[model samples]
Target: MSLRISDAVVWQETGEGISLYHTETGDFRTLNETGSKIWLAVAGGGGAQPVASALSREFAGTDPALIKRIVADVHAFIGTMVDQGLFEESPA
Candidate 1:
């Protein structure tokens, strides 16, 4: 699967993090540093696995279990974004 930012959503980078606004629903979300990175990767057409792998490498020397957790977290993040209508998923 591939991910893309929703057309209805607009985002901006702030000193604290990234802010997302949903035009249709008037919903708003803020992502911290890590989440901002994941959002960028997904917005750049990355899938869950690739994003997770890149994150794992960035945190090199992390425990194996933690790496697995990161993978799970990335998947969960993507799911939540889709559910929140912040992202659109498509078959690759």
Candidate 2:
């Protein structure tokens, strides 16, 4: 599944990171580089596989063994966001 931004949610890029605001619920979230990349990847319709691929490429040779854990962590993190009402699953 991909992800859809909540209704009326606004996002902005700042030097520090990415900022998100949901006007209807008054919920806001701030994300660092990795988070921003994940958010953008999802917003662009990249599903879990593509998301994982991006993460893989990001840290390709740095720590080959850590890639799996990193990808899994991102998936889990995104899943939690869905539960938190920050995002919704979308059709592929």
Tens digits of per-residue lDDT, candidate 2, 4-84, equal 766677888888788999787788879989888888887877777788778877876567778878878888878876877
User: With candidate 1 superimposed using the best TM-score fit, by how many Å does residue 48's alpha carbon deviate from the native?
Assistant: 1.4
TM-scores, all models, native as reference: 0.92, 0.82
By summed lDDT, the worst window of 10 consecutive residues in model 2 runs over: 56-65
Per-model root-mean-square deviation over C-alphas: 1.2, 1.9
Spell out the clash pairs found in candidate 1: none
How do the residues 1-92 of candidate 1 rate in per-residue lDDT, one tens digit apiece?
A: 88899999999889878899999999988999999999989878898789989997787457898888888888898899899899898888
lDDT of 1 at 80: 92
